[model samples]
Target: MLIAETSEGKRVNLSQLSREEITGLKKKKHYCPGCKSEIIVKNGTVIMPHFAHKKNSQCFFFSENESEEHLVGKKLIAANCEKYGIDYELEAFLPELQQRPDVLINRKIAVEFQCSPLSIARFKERTINYQAFGYQVLWILGTKLQWKDSCSSMQRQFVYLSKNIGFYVWELDISKKEIRNNYFLVSSIWKKFYQTQLFSLEKESVIDILQFPLKNHEEVSYEIASKVACEKRIHCWNQQLNQKSKSSLQLQEFFYQEGLNLRELPVEIMLPSFQSVLLKEQELIWRFQIYQRIQRDKKMSYQSLYRMLKQNFDKNYPLISDCQLIKYHLSLYLCFLLQNKLIIEKEGYYYPTNKKFTLKKTSQEFLGIPLKYGMINK
Candidate 1:
């Protein structure tokens, strides 16, 4: 259907209507989106339009550049695909594909580009539908929509995934261009696919995987360090070497090293400083580490990885609340890491880099600000 094309450069669509129906509606009310008022008809055409308020009429919402907000994301995704040299296309707001997706990339993949709401049900439903078609789906949640008045305005969260319905959620703060969190909704089911070794990664995958945990500020608590080592399946030699006193500064120093590729020690051996061995948790971690390697190697099965993740979470973190809720915090932490460039996703894997990571670098550049002096100082 032909959506509204306004003189003010606004394009609104009633995707449900046909071209004929759109013409019919145009006859009844020459709606001025700016004023939410009906326009008067002169000889055979609409007259000079001015925004007018109708009694008891709710004010028309003049949302800022829906096209820009929606399409910028698609453009970024497109660029990312292009940088990786992948194929894609934008659907715009064409009625034929309204229910389809905002952008159709690779024909086998669909994208719903939205910048509002944390819709749990909607996301779950869409993931299922797109996945059924074996299409990889991505939801670019607009974390940029915050109120100007509220200084406490929170950034929106973004979620991206492939279709298999495996409750695994990895949060990426694209504002910072980092992988924020890596979590499983149904860890048990995730564990199952994981155990089956269902993920393939390219050389770049190693970078994304290893760099993920380093994105966050260096918090080398046993748990954090363990998760980092477990996620990357690579040991931090500096952390291991500085075992006498595990300080955040020490961990930071370890990351500052020039060119160090740490190896994965078997689950049995505890590197010098690690006090507690992740025994029971080792299986889940082992699967995850292997999963990372698979993503890095590009020779793993996604189905197998999903099964392992699902089975592990179900058998272990069975509480729906804990599995879903508490896990988000951990994931968010990972996202912070990615935002800072400490972690990157080059191919299929997430890894750390020798380069320092900072979200301020990218977002500020996008906003045309070298750096907000006061904010940076603060």
Candidate 2:
């Protein structure tokens, strides 16, 4: 029905009213601000029917006044919705009715652009309105147009209400950007540095690189390794004894530090199940020597690896082990490196597989592999 302004007041014009508007009013017939019955428009006249329920009737009212921030936030959300090609509508605001969210998207989306904190009561009211309307709301935390501020804090979280637990809201960190960046980094690194196109395995690394590029692949790997080493800085080698002699004490210490010896070091470092594990002290001296020799000869055999580790450790620390034990340890050490995928194995021999190591295949694809530390299962 059409609403007309007359000397008496606003009146309804049934003849001029379209079928759609009538249906709309009918759908809203049960809605009343006070404990009143359905108000129906009929035959160029408006009639207010009586109702029994007084204070218990459900009703909603609307006006058109909103806070300045609310207006600005709604405009921003509208802009974003337009950019993302989303459908939305701005509901009318009423006086002192604890404003509904800034914008409602696609009838099912609620966006609360929260720049300033609100009381628990106000926040709950706005959230409840969206929830009641069956809208999935996004409470945008942080200030407006502050990209760097948003990126700076690593602990921003999202909260939403649930139907099962009345008024109960759950919170979780934002993961979309982080996950996206990681994937991109892995993909780029795989195509560029490693020359491989296997984007699947390079998931986290790819994402990390995309989010924060630290340089080429070799530089990145060395960076992680160096950081891991420097944090602990555990001196595994003794420098005093071999200082005056031609002893290969530095090489022995490197092996010991890296656990590249006859006996394989146990991976777990449990201390009452509470303390963190100590960092793996790699045999830098021995590893460097092996690395150099492989680069120089263009290949490394079991004989060379054994001679290097055994001679250095035995000569410098003679009472460390016997000949038989030393041989077994060297074999086991090489096997460990191969198992961890730190070194490449080809034709009964091992070689470093990092960016620094030269490979037979010149056209090999290098991809960024994500490195994760601590527990694997959990």
Candidate 3:
């Protein structure tokens, strides 16, 4: 909340002020630009000088408290935008939408630097409302975002979309004083994996604060991610091989009855489903269902698959992004099956190749066989 208005109604940006100017402002008594509440000039030596509401001032955007990290992050970003001539205002109100963004960029794009957690419902409502206002909303995350190696499922709901990138994290690197745009072409949160041929963010201006870990970073990072995906997949399979559980017994009972051990399953059977952010069901289960349904009906249709999975997939699960994941997963995996010749596509329908898959009427394949086969797809 660095920007405020003077008694004379002139806009004041506190971050741009010197210590002497700040002292003068303290005597002048500025007020919040948005709420018109009296504000105080805080010029502490430990942190950047910014304005705060005089004790107990209630603002509309206060359903959640702003942390110290949140304050610093917004100030830095607003200051950086100023330095770059990005044309921004801190906490500018959008009249039509009756909403305020942390930083209004170019009087069009609304940038929010979220440092804390919010429910999925509130997040979606804000995003949808912003979109309804015809203002592009960019969520620049502070501290809460994690890289692939250390990602947790709880943070999945923070995912957002940008034009070029399918799903991206606008990350705040507080220590480095820079931002990172981690764009993913395809990823699986369940696997803690992202598959993008490259990840590159460069400084396009003097105040441009984005950084890619290495030059031509996509090539190096992609190689590493690919290796990690393979290793993790094999590691999971081996772990399952060594473990004792009802799941193991159930898997063995079903697939073994079909004379197919895990290794004998097709490589393409368990290929990772792309960008399944909200999908709680394992890819193996749905893919197996597709194989079985196709065998019974002699065809797989997108509508049919969606209808079937909708019955069992958890609608109660929290969704983080705008995409309908269950629909996308079904479509993408079916496309994979068709591409690998495991299933033949005729017009809009898909038919399984059970005989060529080494199927026999002699034994019934476990319904979980597909899940078991595809569990390690990474």
Q: Which has the greatest TM-score?
A: 3
- Local error of candidate 1 at residue 328 (angstroms): 15
Model 1: per-residue Cα lDDT over 3-59, one tens digit each: 233556454444333455544544544443344344322222232112223445543
lDDT of 3 by residue, 266-309 (tens): 43444542334434325666776777788889876878888888
lDDT of all the models against the reference?
Answer: 0.36, 0.35, 0.59
Which pairs of residues have clashing backbones in candidate 3? 198-218, 254-366, 270-374, 284-371
Kindly report which residue stretches of model 1 are placed more than 4 angstroms away from their true locations once superposed.
Answer: 1-67, 82-84, 92-98, 144-378
| TM-scores for every candidate against the unseen true structure | 0.29, 0.26, 0.68
lDDT of 1: 0.36
When 1 and 2 are scored with lDDT, the better candidate is 1
Better of 1 and 3 by lDDT: 3
lDDT of 2 by residue, 111-187 (tens): 55555445555555665565555555556543432222122111112221111111111111122212111111111
